[model samples]
Target: MAGQACLFCEIVKGERSAHVVMDAPDAVAFLDARPLFKGHTLLVPRDHYETLTDLPGEFLGPFFEHAQRLAGAMESVLGAAGSFVAMNNRVSQSVPHLHVHVVPRNRKDGLRGFFWPRQKYESDEEAADYAARLSGGLT
Candidate 1:
């Protein structure tokens, strides 16, 4: 069950909508609603974890294994040259959920250093299309 008032927990429990790309036993990967790039994805644990340190050690392997798959999908499924994977503890954690960001990258994609610039999908249909493609790549 989700922790009370946690946004990510709500998504995990199917109370909120997300463009889910991968739903594994340990983690769930979904497209970032406000993406740095179109295929940018966020992978979070099924349970609510406020930060990386809060995640139990037993879950580390499975959680990161899912992250690895999502990173690979950024290239294989999304046709990006590479991907950027990162996580913010409590300092910059927008939703306060333990989420790993897997952002698709290509040369001259306008991202520089650690400053992220957010963008939106042209429409919900477009976001769903990206989610479907990434889901297919993960399988």
Candidate 2:
């Protein structure tokens, strides 16, 4: 990733605060500080891997297992019609560490192509509420 100062690594290590939605031994899911939607979540591996190819073969299954749960939570918990799940290996990856974006989706959500209009929670309390709901759905 971005050496020892990786942002996602900081979140994984609890050095930075994030509205965490799912915490497991291998991965951590959290609400996007700048969300694409209210319930948008980012799922990252606890370990720092710069890109998808950097991830160990053994880690692939466990990493995506958490993603599956998050995608489901977008619908099961947030009442979204469906979900949009994606990852960028290097080109469009904002953070150096690998992560997948799990965004709630509806038929007329107005998300066209790769251009996403970002959104924000009304407040931290609202963000936390979303985190709590998605977090519970994973269990």
The TM-scores, one per candidate, come to: 0.95, 0.96
Q: Each candidate: how many clashes?
A: 0, 0
lDDT of each residue in 70-100, candidate 1, tens digit only: 8888889888999999999989789988999
- Model 1 clash number: 0
**Per-residue lDDT for 85 in model 1?**
93
Clashing pairs for model 2 are: none
